[model samples]
Target: MTTTPARERTRHEIVRQAMGLFQDRGYSAVSLQDIASAAGCSKATVLYHFNGKAAVLAAVLEPAAADLAALVAAADQLSRAAAQEFAIGEFTDLAVRYRGVMDVVQELIPFIQEMPELALLVADGIRLKGFLAGSDDPLEQDLAGFALNGLTAECRHADGRTDEELHRLCEAALNRLFRPS
Candidate 1:
């Protein structure tokens, strides 16, 4: 059965509230009661909307994935150089936005072997591999994606590195990844 508008509103409210809480406190620390309180509803309402914490975590990941997809699609509109910069910027934004969820992704990596839906959300991120100039080569694309993932981690944890310096490093990494042999 489909949710009524009011119910859908309540569900959206619950997820939105949960996103902020999860982002601030991470996956393990947040409780259903906390989401309900933040959404100005009862704990039962939170439970009704989401079965449990994992569902909420998946919901939180959805928007970040969508945002990255949109950013990557938009890069197609720019000059190749600008598009590369856009790709790196998009990568950096996701790392910054989901710093809290990093551990969750890491922990789930092994378990996703049996969780297709959960893994699909992550698969969407692999589209980022297309940013490589040698994207026609699947191996190169995969390598570039892994390298960019590392760059994002570097950018996220870079102690006192100026934004310009971090961006330069990211660009240089991408350049090295796709540079003609």
Candidate 2:
């Protein structure tokens, strides 16, 4: 079995701490010094791992992308009904896990609007795979990811909805997308 390298593990901790700070204070409000103190490391250590705040945020994104990919892959493996349930549950879990970071991300929308290229990269990370069979067009696939984001946001706002309700709603949406007449 592979183990995380010491340096990489430290970097991960630094990034995690940095994420919390960024979420609470936002990107502009945060600094390398702040991250260093939050992480209980030296400024040089933070710099050694990340060139700047942007790099630190981007590093946090990499694992999030991987986690989303894993969820999509798992959904791909399930039967139609089961896949919808999996997608909903997974998406709910992700929304909860990343709400703070996502708030930071939502804060970047205006910047993304100004910088189209950056927006594209962010959108790409949100891209969904071919959740339905024979629907492999890249553009359609990309929209699915965007659609998933919409659902997740809705779920975030929904209060007092039980897990079962959320699962049913999400599964119904995905099922409609995949079911053939």
Candidate 3:
């Protein structure tokens, strides 16, 4: 069924409001009523748009997940060395662009395995980490990959940094982590 323009607008508003709430208060802390209130609607309206809060969280994270999947897909098409470079640049851009969503996802990590909606995102993350590390030894690559991921996520929390600044800082850190010894 074709959605009415008004209905689409309301749905978008709910997702937008819910994203901010999830980013600020985290998934567990933000109730459906909280999302409705933030979106200037009733709890019933929230339920009308979403099955529940998990659906809202899924909606909030969907765009970022799609982008990350695309990044991984693009990197997969390249040669190993090229994929490493491409993934590093693209992932840094994505991390900065979706920093709030990244923050929310980090909060959800303890429960990520249980969230079916986030399974693709987790898989894409592992693939991207492999591209970032680019080492033959599992131990070396895993350590390097986790370091790059951790530093990039932590850099998103840096206050007073523009998106450009965050991107540059994250890129530098990733480069350092992946640099040849």
TM per candidate: 0.60, 0.58, 0.89
lDDT of 3 at 114: 85
Model 1 CA lDDT for position 150: 75
Task: Please report how far candidate 3 places residue 125 from its true position, in Å.
Answer: 1.0
Candidate 1: which stretches are off by over 4 Å? 1-42, 72-86, 93-107, 112-120, 136-139, 160-165
lDDT of 1 by residue, 1-181 (tens): 9757998888888888887776567555789889889999999887787777777777766776677768767877887667666776676566555554553464455454455546656655665666654356768767876785576557546677776666667666666666644
Q: How many clashes in each structure?
A: 0, 0, 0
RMSD for each of the candidates? 5.7, 5.7, 2.7
Specify the highest-lDDT model's number: 3
Local distance difference test scores for all models: 0.68, 0.66, 0.83
7-115 per-residue lDDT for model 3 (tens digits): 8899999999998988788889999999999999999999998888888888899999899999999988988889888887898888888888878887887788788
**By the lDDT metric, which is better: model 1 or model 2?**
1
lDDT of 1 at 104: 49
Worst 10 residues of 3 by lDDT: 147-156
lDDT of 2 by residue, 29-69 (tens): 99999999988889999999887777787776666656777
lDDT rank order: 3, 1, 2
